[model samples]
Target: MAALGWMVLALVFLDEVLAAVAAGVWGSHAGGWPLAVLAPVVVVAVWWAFASPRARWGGPVVRRVVKVLVFGLASVGLWVAGHHGWALALLVFSVVVNGLAQLPSIRGLVAEQERPPAS
Candidate 1:
């Protein structure tokens, strides 16, 4: 489960890096430098907010809620900003893939808490 979480996180980070590069190149050419910077900033901020140690025990509820909220906001932002079509597609894909990837760990954690200890 820990490995899965780390893998998902690594993929998410890679996605962010790719998106940032795409935004920086395309956005700058399109006269949207703010987006080029904002893309990476938002990625870093989301990682810090939800993945930080303070949030370690926040549990599945918090994790899922944060994931949905952040992804939804990011999707909407992409749609509104009207960047590359591929960027929007990639964002949506990452959201769904990451969400699915984390579900097993979240369910396992929940079940572990619910189970009674053996005598």
Candidate 2:
């Protein structure tokens, strides 16, 4: 159940990131369709490279920093796109959920999830 909740939260956060990037890029130019598509592609590429579990980057601190940076960008982008309610919700929910994730019990579960299953 906890793992499922984590997966759902991860998907929600990813969607929020994509939506925010698309919204920002869509408004950055007069004809934004192309840029909107390109923007998300770039963002996703960078995120996968730096933040994903299989990321090229090393160290837990770096991953945590990247996650925070991406979430911050997403929140700001949502605000720029005039989705004030969503922006606020994203920020608040991220704070609460991330805080909960820091609890000792949840932390152990997260560490376990990061480990590979025995073959």
lDDT of 1 at 68: 57
RMSD of each: 6.2, 3.4
lDDT of each: 0.60, 0.66
> What TM-score, computed on C-alpha atoms, does each candidate reach?
0.49, 0.69
Q: What does candidate 2 score on TM?
A: 0.69
Best by lDDT: 2
In model 1, the Cα lDDT at residue 36 comes to 66
Q: Which candidate is the best by TM-score?
A: 2
Where does candidate 2 clash, by residue pair?
none
Counting only residues 3 or more apart in sequence or on different chains, how many pairs clash (N, Cα, C under 3 Å) in candidate 2? 0
- Candidate 1 lDDT for residue 87: 51
Model 2, 15-104: lDDT tens digits are: 546544644554464246776666667667767778766789736888778767767776777677677787777777766776666666
Runs off by more than 4 Å, candidate 1: 1-9, 16-39, 52-58, 103-119
